[model samples]
Target: MIRKVFSDTGALAKAIDGFVPRQPQTDMAIAVDAAIRDQGQLVVEAGTGTGKTYAYLAPVLLSGKKAIISTGSKNLQEQLYHRDLPLMKSALGYTGTTALLKGRVNYLCPERLERQISECHRPDSEPGQLSQLVKIREWSSYTESGDLSECDALAEDSPLIPVVTSTNDNCLGKDCPSYEDCYVVKARRRAMDADVVVVNHHLFLADVAIKETGFGELIPEADVMVFDEAHQLPDIASQYFGQSLSSRQLQDVAKDIHIAYRTELRDTRQLEKVADRLSQAAMDMRLVMGEPGYRGNWRELQTSPSVEKELVRLSDALDLAHDVVKLSLGRSQLLDAAFDRITLFKARLARLKDTSITGYSYWYECTRHHFSLNITPLSVADRFREQMAEQGGAWIFTSATLAVEGDFAHFNHRLGIDAKQQMTLESPFDYPNQARLCVPRHVPETNSFRRANKLAALLGPVIERNQGRCFFLCTSHQMVRELSALFREQLSLPVLMQGEMPKQRLLAEYLSLGNALLVATGAFWEGIDVRGQALSCVIIDKLPFASPDDPLLKARIEDCKLQGGDPFAQVQIPEAVITLKQGVGRLIRDQQDFGALVICDNRLVTRAYGATFLRSLPAIPRTRDLHHIDDFLSGSDTDSNTMQSHLLDQPIEG
Candidate 1:
């Protein structure tokens, strides 16, 4: 029956305009159906070209089950809800409704937006700000859902955004003036009534956190949970389980108070003064911390006496802001929200200041425009397991990359999942025939110009031969900048760097310019799909490894050691393997796609641990010869397309 659902005349196939069925997709559909029927847990690693989305969605629609489809990327969420779901419902002729729901921060709080527009219209408001407000106000009128995505002109992190958007701590639920037409309420109601709800991991984890607290809920009644990109769930879950306070939050609070004080029923002068002080405190806190960079663990920062004194002043200013906002709480819901936010912010800061708390780690991070302090739990497996037990639903976890080396032990243990069944489905693409692996013999360190030039020599010919259809992925931003500069100085092709434009725009340019060498870092590593000749080669600077000095990485390492485990073999190596796999996965997106994956770091051929990274990749031909790589990219290597390689079947856990 599951196979029939994907047949040529089946509803899923008929609903889609140009649908083709594959054996792996049908197999996945069968597995999902069985998992749902048994009310058990499943860990499935499906390779690219498996049509995993439809494999899961077809069963979900056919079963008439109330399911929550959680994805890692918002772009994917929108794609599913807007395109995939509608096509399935229409083709299958299903009666169930589907809804797209994102985190609270994604939607515009109308009550807050109206107040902002009203203030922006005043004579004292800057012309530029008022102009932006008028444009937004115009958009809000016709935007049926009031989603921020409708206003493409406004950047997500714009100062104007905090003026209109509301967070979990500041939303005026049913007491707001726009209660009747609240977009969030309407969206939630749709999800509650629908058979399937689509949500990103952040919103899904938020709902879990909210339900655990016994608060008023938004998670609909669901019997099954379908997780796409499940590899990221465990890492993202840690964020929601922990607590953090950022300069952005404080800035938002101060901005809200300033806007609210203009019309509150109290003496506006004192409140305005207090609001300015609060904003100043937030700014001063970031200033005293450092000059636009991460200053890990507050303990390291406390040695600077001036930083300590500024922190004290920030605390005092918070106290004053909270007291003033409390006095104006009854004036309006906005003021009430400001008061609540101030109180919560102060409490979080207090907890962060307390060093006696066990089972947790604290750190401070600063950037050019913002700073943050986080109190993160050492581990969240127990809490995650508890939630899983409480939910008592059939959980289906699927991703392209999940296993370390044909084994799911690392993934299962990290998420505290006891899987009833598991499977690994390899991609149908002919890797040995379709692609080549090239690793130069001489590894170039970052600091050496001779090495950079040598590295450029190794890559420049490949790019020129391939007509500039390549991606240079690095582990660090500094590396990206450095490589981009070198490329601009040497090779002449339409060079596009990551931060030069928005991701979508950059991708568009890359697609349009058939021969373009795009230099990027982590953002382009995954979640990007460019098939055919547009992206024929991927060059990675080094193994994609998280910096050990990073606070989060340090905390995770300590957490594993406390449990009597090797952090490198258990944590660091596995992470790097998975990330390298993601970068390599970009090569074989379609059956017809062909590309070369190049790693300049000779570690893969020289170091003992390189075997682990090599095993995580598909069993493909490998070579240290650059001539074969050049011949392959030039499409002239006709002598037996497959090169022999000593491929390992397992990760070297030692």
Candidate 2:
């Protein structure tokens, strides 16, 4: 049955978007089906052009199993839930259901909206804050899922956002007044009954680590869990397994206390005083930390006395405030929510007070608006393994880059997986003919101070020849910011950076612009899918290594060294290979996709460790000459034109 479906995947591809099918995609479907049938673990390295979404979805839906499909980004989750699942359902002629569920924070809380609106009538209300609140109230009437993404006008970092969404600490669940009409409850109810469910990695990891009572438990319902971008799992799991507190979290706590107090408390003056004290303490904490993103682990932080004193005051204020608020007169949903939030906040502070967890690294990340205290585990392998065993399901982990030198040991060691059952699905795209890896003849070290201007001068003609159709990726945000300034000065094309706009809006603009260039950091390297002519070349700046001085990486390396292991090769090289492969995967998204990958760092050609990075890539042709690079780009231009014309002839599908 699975073979028949794979053979007929051509029809599935055409049903939704006029997509062309590839043999690798079909073979992957077969392997995934076996994993599901046998109820075992499977790790697959599906290359860029493998059509992974449909390949996995077809088998899962066809099997009629309650499967959880987790993607790496919101964009991919939305696409799979809204775009690919419907097509897979249609082509397989199945009538079962599908649902999309994000974390609790993604959905709006009806209780929050009511309390916020009532508090808006106070004399101290900001001029336009109420209007934005009203706008959200109006939008909520027709919003189905209550997911914030439906509100196109709302900025993600808006002050008004906390007024609408509920955090884990504040969510009252069944105790909420609007429990019957709650969006999160309704969405999860649908997911519990649906044949297939889609979620991002955050929600999946949150469910694994948190296991909060009342609403946030997600486990054992599905027989199998498919992790789409499994390379990102280790990093995400580390964060979720740890604890973090931000100014945003503290501010939300204060705001909720106000809403609850105004509605119920007799002595609102004392409530107001305590709330203001906590808010001021949070601000002072930020002020004491002078620079943005000034990071230091707890051991290093002990040397600073002023910051430590402020943190102690903040914790005491929260403790006193929680006591004062609970002695209120009336009871409402807001009161219950505020009480829970206070309890949770105090517990989190208690966790942050300790820096002696044997296998954890405690640190703080400071910014302009707030400072975040983090306690991240040095190794999440054991914790993740326990979560996996507790969940008790067949696990399938797939990504474009999971293996190094055709070995999955590094990935397995980090995630605590023994991948005796594994598959490597190579791209069916003709990489040797369609793609070329190029290194400039006179590439300089990325560390050189003059390299910024030198790189722009060298790549200006390359971008011009390709008509400004390029993606230049770098290892750090500072480097990208510098290159963006340099390129805008030298190049005539429209240049865009990551932070200039929202990620999706920027990507939409990049698509609309006929030929444009982008210089971005690691965030753009993966989970971005752009096909056809517009994205024909990807240029990387360095070997993408983590600095040994970085707090978390340093702690991790120390642990590795203490265990008598080679930290550079064991931990660093494999991690870099995974990142470099993600950047290179941007080009050649499809079979007709022809492009060149240019590396401006000469280490890939001159250093001995270069072979590891090279072997991690697909079997694409390579060169170290300027002439060969030009020839490949020229050929790509011709192929892109022909492919665009062909697409115009095909029947368009939405």
- Where model 2 places Cα greater than 4 Å from the true spot, the runs are 8-22, 155-159, 213-218, 329-333, 636-654
Report the Cα lDDT for residue 98, model 2: 84
Q: What lDDT score is found at residue 440 in candidate 2?
A: 75
What is the per-residue lDDT of model 1 for residues 118-218, given as tens digits with 9 covering 90 to 100?
Answer: 78777888779877877787888888888887787687557787777777777777778898888777787777777788988888886676543111254
Candidate 1 weakest ten by summed lDDT? 645-654
Candidate 2 — which pairs collide?
Answer: none
TM-score between candidate 1 and the true structure: 0.94
Q: Indicate the residue-level lDDT of 547 in model 1.
A: 82
Tens-place lDDT digits, model 2, residues 4-123: 565535556447555555678887788788888877788999887687777788878877888899999887899888977877788888798888988777788888888777777889
TM-scores across all candidates?
0.94, 0.92
| Model 2 weakest lDDT span, ten residues long | 645-654
Off by over 4 Å in 1: 7-20, 122-124, 152-159, 211-220, 291-295, 445-454, 640-642, 645-654
Q: What lDDT is reached at residue 508 by model 1?
A: 94
TM-score of candidate 2 against the unseen true structure: 0.92
